[model samples]
Target: MEPFALTVALPIFGLIALFCLPSRIANRRAKLVRNLVTTVVGVECLFALSLTVGLAVKGVPSQSIKLIEVWRDLGLNLDVFVDGAASLMLMLVSFVGFVVSRFSIRFLDGERLQGRYFRWLGFTIGAVSLMVVAGNLLLFFLAWVATSFGLHQLLLHYRHRAAAHRAAWTKFAISRFGDALLIGALALTYYAFGTFELTELFSRARDLATSASQVTASHVAIGWLLVLGAVTKSAQFPFHTWLPDTMETPTPVSALMHAGIVNAGGYLIIRMSPLVALAPTAMISLAVIGAFTACFAGVVMMTQTSVKRSLAYSTIAQMGFMMLQCGCGAFSAAMLHILAHSLYKAHAFLGSGSVVSQALATTGAKSPQPSPHLSLAYLLGAAAISAFAYAAVSSAFDVNVVTKPGGVILALVVCLALTTWGWRLLSVGEITTMLLGMTGISGLCLAYTASYLAVSHWLQATTPLFAIPPTPRFVLLAIALAFCALFWLHFVVIRRVRPNWLNSLRVHAANGFYIDTVYRRLLTPLARS
Candidate 1:
């Protein structure tokens, strides 16, 4: 067996063994199962480590390695092909799985559901392992679906806890919605290009010999749809709210999803980047959404009280940053951040549980808030992101990047100065200052999105056919100056919005639109009928 196959196969085998083992021996059974699980997971981790070593030594050597046949005559097969990105993700998944398993041992000490829990856990690992290495889109899709199933089960691991059960189903339902979108995209992929091989599809997509299903189904359309698949899976933008709420699952599950599987979306974008490049709109969309989501989630994190929820929001924000990197053509750097953050985030969540567990074990009840220094540190860290986003976007201010030197700088100063100053005001109970900070953050989000869209279009030199003709430079300058006036006018609205502005923003934010409400209104009665 190929080295990669060993990594993928071990998890499958472990899950099989876990489920097959009888559940009646009490402590004797748990201990035996624990030992066996440790051994299997340990072996899996080694295989991943070996692949990583091999990659580092030899650098992403791809070979055609057959793993299974999902179909016979229809040209469907499960092939695991190793690339630099896939190897890295597998290592991350396996490493996290090892840690979570170790934690599970101590945390789940006498839990009767250990067998089922490990089974789902192993299955999730197996699916993600296959997913990251899948050479074909169909195989990748299968693994994607399998990964979702594992997540669904993992979320429901504490079936007795209604919140746990509810979170599991919520995750399942949201994931299913994405699944439908992905299935459609896969169908379109196959229909557009006859073969499901992801590599071949990208190679042929630019010069399609096949007819499109619709005249309007151009390169941009397919790219947009595929990106929709990516965003939904990766949990970008509008697709994001689901991820933050998913913390109802055990902390371990959150770690795995955010640190490992969430990055899968990024991996997909990178793997299919060639095809994505052909669809500039998709890239730009990602850039804009990623930018806003990163900033939005990061800011929201500051408001959160739950430690896990804070991390969850942080994951959302960071994922947006990764997407922005991808949009801006800084893939290698994005991968580095993903790698570093995965370790840190997993450690943070696991450590949190350990702290909570220890606290309860000793003095009982909830632990106190983090020191004021820590709180201030988090706020300052958030304020500084306006600068980081500014810097990252500033490095290559293309149309594809969402941050403009001007816009990003403005947002940065406005957000940081306002937020920091607002903190001072809030310290002295200045509601006006607090509201100003709130409005500043909101404005920054919109500005970030606009920058994202412009950058995306810039990357591919996409010009809107209906765009207004450009005026003379001096004429444009006059308009630009006029816009400066308009910007302040908008700021004035933000200024006057008052202390209770968040309450109004809440209505917009809560309904997640009036957009969500509109969507519900449109979809709800139709579904009921």
Candidate 2:
């Protein structure tokens, strides 16, 4: 069988079995349901794994298979496009789906709604796989909508809970609005190019680039529309409240939503790199919003008391960071972020129930803060060591550093981390131990940078390298500097300062700067009416 068909078929068959099987059968033969779903998803993961391995060994094949001929003259068809990006996404979704399915087998063992949960889970996984591999705008859009509805079923699993219902409704509303923007973007793309085929659209884009018309307002509008849809889907800024509130759903659903589904926004942006990069306004908007959202979400995350809610805010921050990478034309870096975050967040959400116990276990071993007088020396040591590490890693890995703002900023972040680590080691006041610790930290930093560069290079096949616009790139650098400065200030104030004014500041930060409250007051009336 063809790879694309197999990719879509395995999951669909599982979903069909899930939907067709009787509820009575599921309840009475719960083991059967578990085995059947697990086996199906396991096989699907194997298929994706094989596809990924094949692609890795043989390189990406630029071929698509059309299953239906909608209109011969207009280039309309039901097509499954296979490429590095599609394969990577399919592998990620299927692998996560399989893991989640296995987990649910044990997690939801005796629940009355086990069958219903797996049913929607299977459908959602299948639909998202289809969306990732979709060859045209129509198929992608249709699958996108289907995935949304299917996920809604999962999100609202506890329909009796008011919070679950509210969160699901909020998600539904935002999803619908995003769906509309995607449709509009699709319509505009069709209007501009006269077809929805991905390859053909990109080919035409290349052609238009060299022409006198270069890029028109319609193309720019499409880019903005696409960004809006992505922002909403990924829960950036104001569209983000629903995600945290969505903690009312089951833990497994939270894992899936954060790890795999929410990543679609970044995927969309990266997938459309050829087009989005052409629209300066769209790029700027993505960067600005992404920067703000990252900062806002990170601050909010710090103040979150609940484990799940904190995880939710962390997701928001990570998603914003991913979007920022895309906006900076660091598509490959963004893809790396997506892949890494998906795996990490999946583990985080799945294991969140253990957080309280873990905290209790570690409560007695907290490290003491270093003296404030050492801050200046620590800062200097961090700067020097980080610079040396950057040069060493860049040379050893042969990763291009100076050419891209993303690479530069990433190196800076590595330096920041190392600097903090070095500061703590130096605070010990033992020269021999400090020297040994510094050597170990340096080696670790080298390994991390080298490994990251290697993975990013491998993923470059799927994600096109992007060039940042000067203005937005400057804005990104400014944000990075501001973040670093604020981080240092936060540490200094918390450790050294005894000012009473900061009490109110801490309160505001804890309340998310009252942004969500303001939003509720303003939007509640609209929601009621």
Q: Each prediction's Cα lDDT score?
A: 0.62, 0.77
lDDT of 1 at 316: 83
Please give each candidate's TM-score. 0.67, 0.90
TM-score of candidate 1 to 2 decimals = 0.67
Q: Which whole-number lDDT from 0 to 100 does residue 121 have in model 1?
A: 69
For residue 354, what is the lDDT in candidate 2? 94
Report the error of model 1 at residue 183, Å: 1.1
lDDT score at residue 167, model 1, on the 0-100 scale? 51
Please state the error at residue 41 of candidate 2 in Å. 1.6
Off by over 4 Å in 2: 1-8, 16-30, 71-74, 363-367, 421-448, 451-456, 459-468, 471-473, 493-498, 518-529
**Stretches of candidate 1 above 4 Å error?**
1-28, 68-72, 205-219, 354-529
Inter-residue clash pairs, candidate 2: none
| Candidate 1 C-alpha lDDT tens digits along 444-506 | 545654545433332221111111112223532443344344333333333334346655644
RMSD (CA, Å), each prediction: 9.9, 3.0
- Cα miss at 199, model 1 (Å)? 3.6
